[model samples]
Target chain A: MTGPHGYSKDKDAHLKRLRRIEGQIRGLQRMVEEDVYCIDILTQVSASTKALQSFALQLLEEHLRHCVAHAVERGGPEVDAKVAEATAAIARLLRT
Target chain B: MTGPHGYSKDKDAHLKRLRRIEGQIRGLQRMVEEDVYCIDILTQVSASTKALQSFALQLLEEHLRHCVAHAVERGGPEVDAKVAEATAAIARLLRT
Candidate 1:
């Protein structure tokens, strides 16, 4: 059976957020397709961008706790590599 | 014991790719700081965008195989939720 860290818990919450984001994305798509004002499209784009960044941050947190921590327990160069890689990914997400 | 699906596997390669992308990101930052031409910055931005897209694609593949597939096996509404969530994430990544 799966525990809290087993990717089962919290999935429903994630899905709801994703569905909302999906709606936002479709709205953006329609904005582009319908030749909306440039500033309006840009504003929607910025909102969508923030939504995606937030989502990435959430995923990064889960990955760090469940994936990276689990990998570190194995004790090897690979653990260090994963830490570095995940950190870099987080940094990249923050940079954008 | 860790198996092939464990996060440890393939980490080093991901780190190396991340480091290269980090260097590219830093370069972009420098360009912005130096007030480089707008087009030049935009071009670098596009490159970095593509790099991120590629990295996200790779991570999505791993997440699908290890995370989503594993979640599906446990059998619950949560499992379907996770699959839908991950699929939605991949779709968003592709859209951008």
Candidate 2:
């Protein structure tokens, strides 16, 4: 299930984390349905958000350490493209 | 910047949060470059990860509340499409 960056090494771990996040989202929905207090629901929402972001950062780190590093070592147009792609991804994530 | 969801109301806030995340990532790179203790680096990584996840969850919530809800209200094939799209997105985020 790896992408072009070959991040599949930790694929299982990533999936597990994501499944938990899905659960968290479901919980948030239920909380809303049950008319939970605003602050309490927001708190859980915060927790869920943190969990997802943590997963993203770890994925990004692996991409940098493995894919980007190898591309840099190869040293050519691919390197420029990889760097640009990674930078753009970072920009996108920040905007997100 | 808002996309179809018209999430522009909080665009400034999202951008600000993302800028902070960009700084955190940069700080992480510096930490690795400086050979910071592995445990300490991991701790900071955890913090940064949490921050990013929080952002994502919030974004998803907004997408569901504003975008998906509106689509559902319209009541047509687009409603199903929007729900499917959102579900697929959740699946992707979880896999990530």
Candidate 3:
């Protein structure tokens, strides 16, 4: 299902964060092109990874607060399914 | 310390991957802009995160195969320091 989903409320903020991350990724490319130190590049990679994770966490929080909460209020099998889906997504985040 | 590190050998490949990741991040921005589903966005985030980690692993492999190995071949406290530094980087990767 497409959206206007749970994260729609923070869409601007999320887009801004993603753009910043995009810039960071571009910076890494420049580092590679310029032959920057490996350790420094690796450090930047870590920072980028962390930024992606942080963004995911924010979106997930909103999903739980909105989508999952609504499903829970309805009190049906869909609630269980929504919760499970959310959990699986969290697992994916952790695995990375 | 910069310019022509171990990863320089694969500089083109690394730059290619980083550029792809930058594209992915931009895709994410478009997704957010279009208001794609929360779960779908999260999935993309995981993919991007995995891609970053994969790039990092490749870099680390080269670093160990060349830089760290060189330090060990030198036979001194430099070897120990290099290993420690590498281990610390690994730790940072894990925590993220």
Candidate 4:
């Protein structure tokens, strides 16, 4: 049997994006090490942040479409739990 | 004058969260190098993914509240551009 939510169909894509983000992080480190201008470093940081955010948003959509949608279709306590889980997730995201 | 979006008020919080995520990424790399069990690694990956998503969501909310909202208030081509920019971002996130 599969684990709680099974495996994501887009797992590979997610990993690839993460690896790229890792590289970006290293790039950011190098920029800092080289004493890049304050605004320039900030700009790179913003871009890296956006890339990571994009990756996260894609995963959230997948979770909702696959895990959450599947749990919702089953219709039981799992449905409530899954909905709560997603709601909690969204709440965390919205939290400042 | 400030750059396109000026600067985020919660910039420090965002940086802190991203730094935490960098640690998590490092932890994942260690898990892999150590040759942890497949399922265990996958589980950790899932958790990291969620954490990153939460960070991104928070940033997106901030962009909407500050950048997008400010653009709308100003009213011009900038408003259209900002709306389009946010829409493109959302679309990117939604992509499977």
lDDT of 3: 0.92
Worst 10 residues of 4 chain B by lDDT: B1-10
Q: Which tens-of-lDDT digit does each residue in B1-96 have in candidate 2?
A: 124343446656665765665566556555544544333444555565566567667767887887778878888889887777767666654543
Off by over 4 Å in 1: A1-7, A91-96, B1-96
What's the lDDT for residue B35 in model 4? 42
**Candidate order, TM-score descending:** 3, 4, 2, 1
In candidate 4, what are the lDDT values of residues B1-96, reduced to their tens digit?
Answer: 243332355555655665676777666555444444333444554565566556555656766777778878988889887777767665544441
Ranking by DockQ: 3, 4, 1, 2
Query: Candidate 4 at residue A75, lDDT?
Result: 78
Worst 10 residues of 3 chain B by lDDT: B1-10
Tell me each candidate's RMSD, in Å, in order: 11.5, 15.3, 1.0, 8.8
Q: What is the TM-score of each candidate against the true structure?
A: 0.45, 0.49, 0.97, 0.52
lDDT by residue for model 3 over A1-96, one digit each (tens)?
Answer: 767788898888999999999999999999999988788888999999999999999999999998999888999899989989999999999899
Going through the candidates in order, state the TM-score of chain A alone for each one: 0.76, 0.88, 0.97, 0.83
Residue-level lDDT tens digits of model 1 in A1-96? 245663446789878888988999999889889999999999988888877876765676566555655554455676556655764674465346
lDDT of 4 by residue, A1-96 (tens): 243332354455656776777776666555444444333444444566566556545656766776778777887889887777667665544441
Task: Show model 3 residue runs off by greater than 4 Å.
Answer: none
Best by lDDT: 3
